[model samples]
Target: MNIHKFFANDEIATRPLHHVMRAGIFLSLIIIIFISMSGRPLAQTIEYDLKSVSVLKINLPVSQAVTIVLSDAVSKIVAANAEIADAQPITDKSIYLVGRSFGTTTVNLYSESGAPVGLLAVEVGVNSADISRSIRAALPRSDVKVNTVNGRVQLSGSVNDAYSMEKVLEIVAQYGSPSIVNVITLKGGQ
Candidate 1:
C-alpha cells in the first residue's frame, strides 16, 4: 500500500481518497451536532413587572437556594412571605434566596437610597436537597441521607428508632415530594 498514491500524485487513487475524506467530514459534522444538542445551558429569567418587577423568576425547590447578584448594590431585602421563602444579603450586590415552604413568594430588593430595585419571584418546589436538609435539622443526630431518583425522593441511611425513621418521612412529605422512597433502616447502633 503506497501512501503517496492516496495523495496528490496518483489521480486514479484520488477517487478512493475523496470518499474517505467525505466520510471523515460527515462523521465530524455529526459529532459536532450531537455535542451541541446534548449539552444545553440552563437559563434563568428575570421578571419585568411594572408594579413589582423581579430580578429573577426562580423555580427553586424547598430547602435549596440560589444566589442573586445585582448590578446595583442592594441595601435592604424583603421577602413578601417569610413562610415561603427567605432572603439573606451576603453582600451589597448579592443575596442568598432560600426556599422555605411549598409555595410562592417574591423578594423585594432595595437600593442604598431606599429606592426599589427589583423583586425575585420565587416558587418553592420539592427536591431532595431541601428534604435532606429538613431531616437533618429536625434530627441532627440521625444518620439519614436523601436524594432524588426518577423524580422520587429516596431516603437512605440508618436511624436509632422507628420514631426517627417516621419523622424523616414526614419531613419529605411536607415538601410536596412527588414520591417517597423510604429505605431508612432502624438500627440499634448510632
Candidate 2:
C-alpha cells in the first residue's frame, strides 16, 4: 500500500521502469510513423488551368421538390448527350442534383475560347434551400462566384460580355423558386 516502496525497491522496479520507458518510446515512434505516412502526398499534378471563381447568394428560399426534379431531369438529358462525358455531384443542392448525376457536365459546355456557350436550367419550381444548395455545389470549378444577400441571389463572375451574362442568367433562372424576386448578374467589368 506504500507508494514509495515501489520506486524505492531498485531490483524489483528498475527493470519494469526501463521496459515501460522503452514501450512508451516505441509507441511514440509508431504514432509518428503512421502520421507521416498518412500525411505524405501522392504524386499528383495540380491543374494550372483553374480560374478564380466566386458565387454570391441572396437571402432566398427554395423548395426541395423542384430541386430534386430538376437535377434528375438535367442528369438524364446530359447523360444522353455524347458531348457530355459525365456529370459530377456539385455542392449546390439544385445543381448538385444534376452534377451528381451528370458529372461535371458544365465544364464540358465551355467553348474553345473558355467562354460558356450553353446552360441547362430546370423549368420546375424549387424552394430557397434547394436553390442555394445547388448553386453552392456548382461553384467550385466556376471562375466567377454566386452568393445571397438580403433575399436575392447575386451572380458575380467574368464572362465574354452582356450576351454571356444573359446566358448565365437563363441557366440559373430554371432552378429558382416561384417567389424568387430577381436574378442579378454583376458583369466581370469586361
Candidate 3:
C-alpha cells in the first residue's frame, strides 16, 4: 500500500510538469508569430514608373517633334507625381509652342490659363560636342556643363530659373525618348 501511494505521488508531480511544458511551448510559438507579423510592412508603398508612363521614342522628324512636345506635356504630368513623391510643388501647366530648328528647339511652359511661366530653348544632335556647345550657348549665364558617355549625355548646372530645366529637357528630347534622351539628364536645383 505504501509503494502504491508513492507511485501516485510521482504521477501527480509529472502531470503538472507536462502541463507547464506545453504551456511554455504554446507561449513561445505565439511570441514567434507575433514578432513575424509585426515585422511585415505597415503602410502600402506608392510606386510610379516615370519612364514607362512618359518616355516615348521618335524617329520621323514631324513625329519626333509632335511626340516630343506631347512627351514634354506628359512628362510634366508624370513628373508632377514624381515631384509630389519627392516633396516638390507643381501646378497645372502646358506648352503653347515648341519648335525645333537646326538642332535647336524652343519650349514654352504656360499656366492653365495660357500665361507663360518660362521659356527654354536648346539644341542637340548625334554629336555630344555640338550638343555641349549648344547647351553652353543656350545657358550662357547658368554655367552649364555636359558629360557624354556611351551614347548618353548628362547635363548638370545651376540655372537662374525654371526655364533652364525646360531648356535641358528640350535638349534631351531632341536626341531620343526621355529614357535615352541623349543620355543627357539635367539636374537642376538652387
Candidate 4:
C-alpha cells in the first residue's frame, strides 16, 4: 500500500505535523520574549526617597581597617572626605573602610543597579593600644585594662587608691574628654 494512501485513511495519522511544530515554536518565542523583557529596565530612572535615607554609625581605629557587610550588592562606594577615611569595595556585598585621620566622614554605598544603598557615618579615632601602654606605665602597681568601644575609651579594672584612679582618668581625658568610661574600682571600695 502507498504510505500517503494509508495515512490518509486514518484521520489521526493524517494530522498535519507542521501545526504541532508551529505551536511549539510559538510557545518557545513567547518564553524567550518574556525572559528578555524581565531583564530590561522598566523605566529610565529609579527614584529614591532622599528624606528617608538610612544612616549607619561606624567607629574605626586610626590606621586600621574594618569590613562592612551590606544588605545589597554594592557597585560603588564614595567617601565624603578621603582625608578622614578610605572606602574600598571588597566584593559586591561588602566593603573595607580604612581610617586615615582622627575625624568623621560619610561613606555612600551604591547598589549594582546604580541606586544609593545608604550612608555610613564613619568616625576615625585613636586605638587603645597606645593609651593602654601609657596607663600601665603610669600605674605600674595597679591593674588596669583599656579598650575602645563606639569611639569611646573604656577603662576597666582596679586601682590602688583614689589618687591612682584620678590619675588614670586625667590621662584618659588628655586624649579626649567625654569619650572615656572609667569603670576602675578602688582597692578597698566596691
Candidate 5:
C-alpha cells in the first residue's frame, strides 16, 4: 500500500485519539477546579483553646493520660514530637494523649477523608506526683495542694502566711511550666 494511502485510511482512528485526549484534559481541569473551590485552604492551622483541658494537655511519664473529645470522627493523628508524646485513638470521637517526655508539641487530628479536625497544643511536663511532692517537702504544713491542669501547675488550698504562699509559688515556678495558677488563699489576712 502507498504510504499516503495508509495515512489517509488511519485518519478516523487518529480522530478518536484526539477526542480522548481532549476529554482527559477537560476532566483534569474539572477536578482541579472542584478541589480549589472545596473551601478547604491549602495551609490551615486551626487554633483551639489552649487553656481548656478538653483541648490538649498531658504530663510526662504517662502516669496519667489526657483524653481529648473530638467533634468528628478521627481517622488519623500526627504528633509533632513522637518522643515527647503519643496519641492513641480510643474511638471515633475520643483520643488518649500519653506523655513521653517533658516538652511541648503539636498534635494534628484528621478526619477519615483527610480533612483536618483540629490542632492540639500538647505540653508534656514533669509528672504531677513529683511536682506535688517537691512542693510539700519545701513547705511543710503549708496546706498547699498542687495540681496540673492543661500543662499548668495549679496551686490550690490555703496557706497560713504570706511567706509560705511565696515559698509555694517559688517551688512551683522551678518546674518552668508555661502557666501557673496560684489559687491559694491566705488565712488570718496575712
Candidate 6:
C-alpha cells in the first residue's frame, strides 16, 4: 500500500494506519455531535411523493372546501369515509374536497385507465383559532399547547402529570381527529 497517499505531509505519514483510522473516526464522531447539537434540522423533510406531494394533502376545516389540482387526469375518486369528507371533481385534473364533518380520512384517486394515482389524507377540523381559544379556557392550569399544524393536532409542551395530559387530550379530541404529534416533556409526579 502507498501509505504516503493517505498523509498530507511526511510527519503525518509516521502514524500507523490503525491510529490514523481511529483519529479519523473520532473526528467524524465530533462532527456528527456538533451538527446534531447545532439546533438546525440536518435533514430536510422527505418529499414523500414528488407526484402526489404537490396536491394530496387535504387540510380542510369543517364547512370548507379545498381545490386540489392533480398532475394526472383523475377518472375516479373514492373516500374511505364519505361522511367526514367528500370529493367532487372540478375537472379531469382537479377536485374539491368538501369537509363534511370533524375527522380524518383518506381518498384514493384513479387515472383514466382505472389505475390508482394517489392517496389523499383528508382532515376535517373546526377552525384552528376557535379550537385554540376553547382549549386555553378548558385547561387553565396546564402548560400544554395544541396547534393544528399541517391539518394534524401537534400537541406539544408539558403538563403537570399524566392525568392532566389525558384531560388535555380528551378536550382536544372533540375538535377533530387529532394526529397528536407527541412532544410533551416535563412531568413531575405529586
RMSD of each: 11.9, 18.6, 19.3, 19.9, 22.0, 12.1
Q: List runs of model 6 lying over 4 Å from the truth.
A: 1-55, 133-143, 147-155, 159-190
lDDT of each: 0.73, 0.38, 0.42, 0.75, 0.69, 0.71
Candidate 1 matches the true fold with a TM-score of 0.42
lDDT of 2 by residue, 62-152 (tens): 3211122121122222333323222233322223222122111222223335554334332212333554455445443333455444324
- What would the TM-score be for candidate 6 when compared with the true structure? 0.49
The sequence of per-residue lDDT tens digits that candidate 3 reaches over residues 115-151 is: 5434333332244555567777887776656544322
Tens-digit lDDT string for candidate 5 (73-113): 77889998877778787787777777776567888887789
lDDT of 1: 0.73
Model 2, TM vs. native: 0.24
Which candidate number maximizes lDDT?
4
Highest TM-score: give the candidate number.
6
What's the CA error at residue 53 for candidate 1, in Å?
A: 7.6
- lDDT value for candidate 5? 0.69
Using TM-score as the measure, name the better of candidate 3 and candidate 5. Answer: 5
What's the TM-score of each model vs. the native?
0.42, 0.24, 0.28, 0.47, 0.43, 0.49
Residue 69 displacement in candidate 6 (angstroms):
1.5
Residue 106 displacement in candidate 4 (angstroms): 0.6
List candidate 1 segments past 4 Å from native.
Answer: 1-55, 128-175, 178-190
Q: Name the lDDT of candidate 4.
A: 0.75
Show where candidate 3 strays beyond 4 Å: 1-125, 177-190
Model 4, which residues run further than 4 Å from truth? Answer: 1-53, 128-190
